[model samples]
Target: MRLAIYEIREGDEPHRLAHRLLGDFRRWTELVELNRLDPPYIANDPAPYRARGLRVLGPGDRLLYPYAGAVEPVGEEDAEAETYGRDLLLQRGELALMGGTVAMVRGLENLRGALERRLRTRLGELPAHPDTYGHLLHQYVGRAGGEAELRYILLEAERVIRQDPRVAGVRLEGELLDGEHVRVLAYVEPIPPGSPFPVEVVL
Candidate 1:
């Protein structure tokens, strides 16, 4: 999946707020590591690097902001002022990363079957219908307590439309809402007649 990294600035600094709000330092670090971010270069004494307008982030362009000692997601609009406790800064230290967009699919049900099969081996008995999508399943990994077992099940429903020879393109639309939640909607169109949607299954 494509990932983009945006550094937290003034309004975006969730780390600072986390400490002020939660007063938990260890939890904040855990959030950072979970998102695959490098260990933070924070300090009690502000220096040039702290003043500099760049911060390195991890995979998927996701950053964690410390809120009451717990790391949380910070949106683009809130990044600037959240960086520092002052006026919003225009140019600040930030970085980004991107990934492949060519996703493969055959059909919704086919994709659902594939996901169910794959996850069953890994997570054991998964919860049915965790969210709005009828095809999705949820499983909690990691530990029994804490944020260890939080995992979302995604049905790669776009595969069916994409694999069809008659279909020119397939787009999966969705939103990555707060709290790492995702909602997907499928859209498909035919390429030409005679050459209908492919019936063959790849998996």
Candidate 2:
């Protein structure tokens, strides 16, 4: 298995929030120790890792950090198909969120066409923008609430991804403190044979 560790350093306020939510000031400290990170891998300092491009985390940034367990592709065909499907979903989701109706519809149509061409499978119909809007609204509601709610939402998202057959496992790497606040770094792993993703709760 190939492992890639992505770290996000919490800003001062976020760090405090984490402590409050987890009800343990040393929760993060414990995790850092458990991970056996070296002296330079300090949780309080985002500098060293930022210089190495591992610090992509930001305030309100929900990241999806992927860890590929198998260095070798399960098989060229499966790997290609999985990659294509995931990329298409990401692209479509982003376009749907940012583009206005006219643009979104156009983008969706384009995505459908592209997916069909690449996978020989129709992506089926696209949901109305209002429906998408409502979904997003619900998500926003969940994310905007207290730390407990935020943790629930994060866990739920992880569950959803892990349930997908294409994903082998998922890991949640972030700080969840006691005060109902969080700093997240999440990732997904795909198994050789289709299986739901597994999650490793980092901290």
Candidate 3:
């Protein structure tokens, strides 16, 4: 397989990118191996590898991939039947791999991913629209706060989630995972076209 350059996009994930450009998400290993990336979140080892933390590839990041193929074809059911939205499937910051390829999600799950990501981002983190792109929940992290602060976090999370046109309504709840972390559960009611769903985001 010949090598090709893949300029990562905002939503690009290794497995998903592999599937889109290499005909199989499983080929993400080829990306790591070719790029000589060390202990990416997908590494299968113990201790030190786990301690190194995940490598986040943002927009403009370039990766070398082999077998640059056309984007994977949509499944017959999805193409001929309902047009469920398509997106990369991720779990705990890593791509969910199947048979060496990345897994894919559709429809409501796509919305869930969007909600999770929005809540995890800190307000003003995006340079293009520094004033409007992220959430304030990150500010409360690793600091002392009481009921009022928690309530504010919830409100902020709800506001951020509702920004997605897909979300019709949202109910938020939170728990102190520990002194340094918080987990927010958002039960989102999608627009009339889809069913309601819950998304968990830890910060």
Best prediction by lDDT: 3
Q: Write the per-residue lDDT of candidate 2 for residues 1-203, one digit (tens) a residue.
A: 22222223355332353364345555655433323333333334333343343322222222222343436555654444433232323343344343534232322232233322222111122332111111111242324456556666465445333322233456664454544344444455453323332233222
RMSD of each: 20.5, 19.4, 14.1
Per-prediction TM-score, please?
0.19, 0.29, 0.53
lDDT of each: 0.32, 0.35, 0.62
Candidate order by TM-score, decreasing, is: 3, 2, 1
Please, what are the lDDT tens digits per residue for candidate 3 over residues 1-203? 33344555555666887788778888888766555455542322212332233332334434555543455654544432122246788897689998899998776667678678778777666675454445777667667776666777787777677545345578889887777787889888865346677898777
Error in Å for residue 98 of model 1: 28
The TM-score obtained by model 3 is 0.53
Write out the backbone clash pairs for model 3.
26-100, 26-101
Order the numbered candidates by lDDT, best leading.
Answer: 3, 2, 1
User: Model 2: runs farther than 4 Å from truth?
Assistant: 1-79, 82-145, 174-184, 193-203
TM-score winner, 1 or 2: 2
Q: Residue 57 in model 1: shift from native, Å?
A: 2.7
Among all windows of 10 consecutive residues in model 2, the one with the lowest summed lDDT is 128-137
